[model samples]
Target: MDYDDAYANVPHIPDGESYPPRWAAEAAAFREARATDRNDLGVSYGDTPRQAYDLFRPETAPKGTLVFVHGGYWLRFDRSYWSHLATGALARGWSVAMPSYDLCPDVRIAGITTQVARAIQNIAESEPGPLTLAGHSAGGHLVSRMIQPGLLPIDVTDRITTITPISPVSDLRPLLHTAMNAQFQLTEDTATAESPALMTERLDIPTHIWVGADERPVFLDQARWQADAWSCPLRIDKGRHHFDIIDALKDPVSPLMRDILG
Candidate 1:
């Protein structure tokens, strides 16, 4: 789809009361259960002035760490609401960390990506080995930043084994022309530099790309371009929308989950 067609299908939620209904419901369920089975609880890993991430480790676990970053187009959402995702990975003995960063305008995408690297470094320094990074939507875009050879701090890159970004906005230029630009404040130059598609020459790690079949054409296009550029394996979750595709991680057998976990 062209840029116009892709933007039209992009989902936009107003500032207040803007969360997706499915996320609200799932978050509610997780919150209610938190009081009881808090074994898989969350922890803050970084104390940076403007950035923080919550770590969720499984009790008596057996796998590597999997950091799940939340997405709000680099301007919305929090670590609290996304802790539930850790349950899926934790159940399989994988530790999960979700970091919160200063949104756009207040801090540009470059700054946000930097914070994400720090958050990962904070976790890796304390808990070592076979780390895999994953994120949804904007969060997915941020994780891609870490995969770039020189984009992330040296220490953080050495520990990561693989990366799986689900429904990521790997290419930032597309957002510059879409309604998302109003909040993202992306310039053509910034978009090109921040975009993973343009940064392909820098990708050095094995990465997996996945997107929902029902996502907006723009998102699908972005995913396609990202997969093509990286020459990485691309998995499509049939019938899942952009918002719901990430939820598949909650199910162990989900196509999205399997692609990343395996």
Candidate 2:
């Protein structure tokens, strides 16, 4: 029942420290491999340095666009670490845009939410197209929130074909017990406002919830909560843990990839 221990992931994963370097290396290689197709290395969405995104476009007209957000509990990682995640979407004929945001401690979770909204709007304005938004971990909660009744303008929501938040944290109340709250600084009011699981209003747009079977039970429950509350479909990938669950996003033929591209 210790929320801190229960939610902690890196401690349980022996090689957790290696993940950052691996992500950075893979993202660099992906950029190099797709040098020609890659543009907008650091497109500014806001005035800050981190408020930027990278756009990877296919040579021919893209079927649509996929805006990807990376999750590090709103405190770690950036768009650079997740560039390779665009691979599957790109190969499947979708332009992919990955965005970086100002982290927690520097800003509250509530502020980060707006930053994402701004980032998505900036991308939407720059390259308007049918949009499919996806995020992981904290990113999942973000993409999910973007579709809430008043979060994004109706025009933008109308253009979003689907939203896929992998291993999303639908509810944020539990995090108050975890050490992460130091950076997140959540209160009952803010948690209620941000918890998609607890929200009664449902988005009209289609949504697909995904979580790896091996992830902590909290994640599975969160994913189910969003699916049930929103009347959407959920997919569980057996044997995939929290970190590796995202691997499918880079595989064009993976069921997860097809789900996003569709």
Candidate 3:
């Protein structure tokens, strides 16, 4: 595969940079409409400042909790950027938690994974119910790693019923070939260790992989590869791209949300 073509995103979606600012605006609007008091914002998962999470609830006791990990290729972005994504799941009586972990170069990818696991466990300590995780891009990889056999404690692992990885690069090995490796600093061993695709053992918890029809071939291949390896189903979200495909989570009635909810 052409590594450049596979990883190229902003070039594929002409208005790519605009999406982040728009998403930030939407998140702000979503928070204003909801009660900041109802949200258990900035609950610490780890010792560091970035290792905290925000948990937002519904009117009554939630059926379950759904946590969303925001994507910035393990380089940037955080919880504050994704509050709007809780819109659909919250409307369905689910509490949504968004956790921001320390970015790479500051903390390695594996370190970020551990921090996120800690974040989820921290939430579970109080919530104590079935949990679901959904993430986009690098965030997707982090969420799936929770089921990577020995990565998490059994208690936390048992509570996670489903994992939805949207447009995630399951295999990090390919990424090592790219110029961005300067920032990632992945060795062959760490790449394999952190790659969800290499977790070849099929998991007991159901895994739903989402890929956008309009996304670059490499993004589609990444999700498809993992599905085939695990013998699970893959959902190609029609007419969606890497950035906007996430909007499905913001809409309660969309097919994207329905597929994820199932």
RMSD of each: 3.4, 1.2, 1.4
Tens digit of per-residue lDDT, candidate 3, span 1-262 = 6776669798789788898898889888888888777788889888889989989998888888898998988988889889989989988888999999998788899999999888888888888578888889998898888887776778877888889899988999998988777889999999998888888654588888998999998889999988887676789989999998898898878776665665
Model 3 weakest lDDT span, ten residues long: 253-262
Ranked by TM-score, the better of candidates 1 and 2 is: 2
> Which stretches in model 2 have alpha-carbon errors above 4 Å?
none
**How many clashing residue pairs appear in each of the predictions shown?**
1, 0, 0
> TM-score order of candidates, best first?
2, 3, 1
Q: Estimate each model's TM-score.
A: 0.86, 0.96, 0.96
Of the two candidates 1 and 3, the one with more favorable lDDT, higher being better, is: 3
- Compared with the true structure, what per-residue lDDT tens digits does model 2 show for residues 1-262? 9888788777766697788899899999988887664567998999899999999997778888899989999989999898888888878888999999999999988888899999888888878679999999999999998987877878777889989999999999999889889988999999988998887886788889899898888888889988888888999999888898999988999989878876
User: What pairs collide in candidate 2?
Assistant: none
- How close to the true structure is residue 192 of candidate 1, measured as C-alpha lDDT? 91
lDDT of each: 0.75, 0.88, 0.86
Clashes of 1: 1
Best by TM-score: 2
